[model samples]
Each structure stands twice: as structure tokens, then as C-alpha cells.
Target: MQNNYFAAAPKYQEDSSNQQTNTEEQQIGKKAVFYYKMVAKTLGQYLSIYDGKTEYKMGVVMHQPAKPDHQGGFYVYDSLDQAIFADVPLKKDGLYFAPRTVIKCACWGDKIEYPNGKIAFEYLCPVQDMGMPKGYLATKAAMKEAYQLYSEKLKLKQGAGPKSLKKPTWKN
Candidate 1:
């Protein structure tokens, strides 16, 4: 005969405080930087983003629910060219249709709900395919302009001008 001292005891204490802290941390870490809307078509949805260096193609799953128990819906592609080249549809369950968009974020594994309150998707950081960082081209252009202005100012200080110097050799 053995004495069961902990048989009926709670297997583990429910730490509500820890759970609350975790939820808060998760919310703080899951902020979206930008979002692109992708309308689903009879075939599928596609999103192409060029961050000046790389092109990212984010595909959307169509005619399928995020979960087995989720309500069915349809998404029609807005572009005729895309509709013509979309993948084959899987299921035709719901008559209600709308465009599904993918939210882009810097953090991976972040989840966001759709405006319709029906679907949610996990955000994946596509940094590898993100190519150049955002605003890189614009910043580059600004820097180039500033350099040109500085060169012009230096030339002026050196008593060089259109009347005294030859036409600026550098092309705009």
C-alpha cells in the first residue's frame, strides 16, 4: 500500500499574472509597418512589392477558410490581368466575397484580424526579399542633390562661375 499525497492536488497553479504580462508583451511587439490589400480572384491573389532592390510576391490563399470551422467566402481579383493568370480555385463554399489583404510588418509571426472580423493571418517578415529598405531611393536622390549644391558653393568660393569657368561637365 502506497500513500498518494498529491493525487487530488491541482497539477499546476494558474498564474494569471504571468499570462497577463505575456499578453501585454505580445501586443507591444506586434505592430504593423504597412499593409497592402490583395483582392482574391477565382484563381488566387498576388501582391508584388519592389523595395527598390528586390521584388516580393506575396500570394493569397483563395476559396479556403483559415480554419476548418471558419465560414467560407469568395474574393474577386480587381485586375483583369491578374484574374486571367491566377491559380485554380480549390472550393466554392460561400457566396459572400471580398478582397483579402496582407499586412506587412517588420516582425514575424504577428497575427492580425481582417476588417470584416472573419479572418486573420500571421505576418511573415520578408526581409530577404524586401530588397532595398523603404525610402532608400528617395534618400539617395536627396544626398546626391546636396552634394551637387556643396560642389557649386565650393566653386563659387574659389571665384569660379559660369562667366569665369567652363560649363559644368557633370550631367544632371
Candidate 2:
């Protein structure tokens, strides 16, 4: 096996306009600055699920349980699922549980042909097709519980988890 290493790189650019007399900056010609990035720890794998009714394409990050049993659940997010489907990268803050609002709504549009043959369209949520899932960001234990109910497989009393994550409920 090949050994690998990672070096943290500067994540933010220096502000040229700021002239604070910090001792480090005063003594050094230049310095590399690094910002901490918070990775979204699992409610297990991040995914999207279609609720049969109220919720549309609800984006969820859930942790499915392990072994010969049953039971599971999922925390709900009213944001970013559309953005994820639209190829938005996971933010530095990762998947946050922002309450559902118009800001997170994605839009769909159609080709409108004017009388003169000019075509136009706009992406706007029809409201009727909007996804407003219920539930809050679950506590870690809650996430585990949610997954238990949703996933078909049950967790063992004690053993390792499966090698790969289960697929999302809907295609990205």
C-alpha cells in the first residue's frame, strides 16, 4: 500500500487593506492563513427521498442501522436538496438544517413561444410542486433511529457495518 499525507492549505486570502499591527504579520513578509472547515458528520449517508405526499424531493442525511432487526427514521431538511440535485457542492458548513423557506425552493420552467416565434422561459416553483418536508435536524441518536425504520436491513447486536452506503431514494 502506498502511504499518503495531507497538508492543510491556506483557505482565505489576506486582506491587503487591513493594517493591524499583529506581531506575526509585522515580523513576516507573508504568511499562509488557514480556515477551519467543518465536515458534515453523518446522520449516516446524505441522500434525497420522495415523500408520497407532502414532501417532494426531500434532501436528507441519514444514518441507517446495522444487523438482523428492524426500525428507522430520518431528520428533515427544507433546504439544499434542490441545490444538491443542481450540483451544488457540499458547503464548508456541510448540510445544515435550515428551515424550509422560499430561498431553498428550486424552479422549473417551460419553453414559451411568443407569437413572433421568440422562445422564453423562467424557472419558478409552481408552489403546488414545492417540497416542504416536516421534521428538524435530528439529534445523533435520532438519526440512527430514523434510519433503522426506513432501511430494510436491521442492525446486529454487535458487528461491523456494511462496506458501502445504501443508494439514495431518488436519483440525483
Candidate 3:
């Protein structure tokens, strides 16, 4: 456990230019309509599923019944089924509904050389919304923070965890 703790040292140098570019990109807004929505309470767990080998991030969103035995018939649950809906985290806000607990979307990319040649590859992050009872909003925020922290852990020390398999080519 002690050995697993994040290193106290800083990782890669912070590129102000890259940071500015990311800020611009985020301002662009959502480009697609997600089909899921969560209540902002039932958010249960936030995980960063990594394939150690591939380093692909999978965002999962999961939801369960609001309660058991206490059936609120002829209502939303009755219509939506025992399973509730959770929105994708990468949306304007976590407001949609879905059956899963994770949402994996492209976050960033890197350049690498494949065994055969070279290419550019990218990876995405995962978001999970639990939509708990009355803590939907609060839980959602906490989950987001959890994910953010998970990401920071990776940034704690760069070039040591996972490297991309893509290679970039600049043409004149």
C-alpha cells in the first residue's frame, strides 16, 4: 500500500501553451447529444478502468432501483423500470439517464511508433453517475472529484505509467 502511494515528485513540465489550447477546446461545448441521464444522487462509485497494456480509459455509468419493496407504481420508476438512468459525465451536465455506471470518451492523445511504423493514438476517460436517493447532486460532484483525483494521480509522475502507441507526422 505504501509503495502504491503517488510519488511526492512532480511529473512532466506544465506547458502553458497546451493549457491555453485545452481551455479553448473546452469552450467549444458539447458536439453530440447523450442519451443517458442521472438524478444526481445515486452516484455510487467512480473508477478508472485501465487495461494496463492498452491504457484505454473506459467511463462507466451505473444505476439501480431507488428502493425495493416500496414500489412507487404508475410513476417514473414504473415506466423506467427497476433500473434508473444516468447521464454521461462528458455532457453539458450529468442530467441524462442510462443503465450503466461508466462513460468512456476520448480525453487526450499521444504520438508513438508502432512495431510496423508510426501513428497517432488517443485515449478517453470514464465517468460514473450513481443517482442516489436525495444526494444525487452532491454525490455527482463527489464522483467528479474522485475521477479528477484519479487523473491527477496519473499526472503525479509522467512517462512512467502508460505510453501511447501512436506516432505523429508533420508534413510540409
lDDT of 1 by residue, 45-133 (tens): 22322111112233321122323233322222233333223332333442113222233323223243434332233432222122223
Task: Specify the poorest-scoring 10-residue window by lDDT in model 1.
Answer: 48-57
User: Taking the tens digit of each residue's C-alpha lDDT, what string does model 3 give over 59-141?
Assistant: 42121222223221101111121323322234433333322332322222322323322122222232333334443333345
lDDT accuracy of residue 115 in candidate 3: 37
Tens-digit lDDT track of model 2 for 43-133: 3321222221222222211122221221222222223442222222333443433222222222212323334222222221111223233
In order, how many clashes per candidate? Answer: 1, 16, 39
Error of 2 at 154 (Å): 4.0
- Could you tell me how far off, in angstroms, the CA of residue 170 lies in candidate 3 after the best superposition? 31
The candidate that wins on TM-score is: 1
Query: Which regions of candidate 1 deviate over 4 angstroms?
Result: 1-139, 160-172
- Deviation from truth (RMSD, Å), model 3: 27.3
- Global lDDT of each model? 0.33, 0.28, 0.29
Once model 1 is optimally superposed onto the true structure by TM-score, how far is the C-alpha of residue 118 displaced, in angstroms?
A: 34
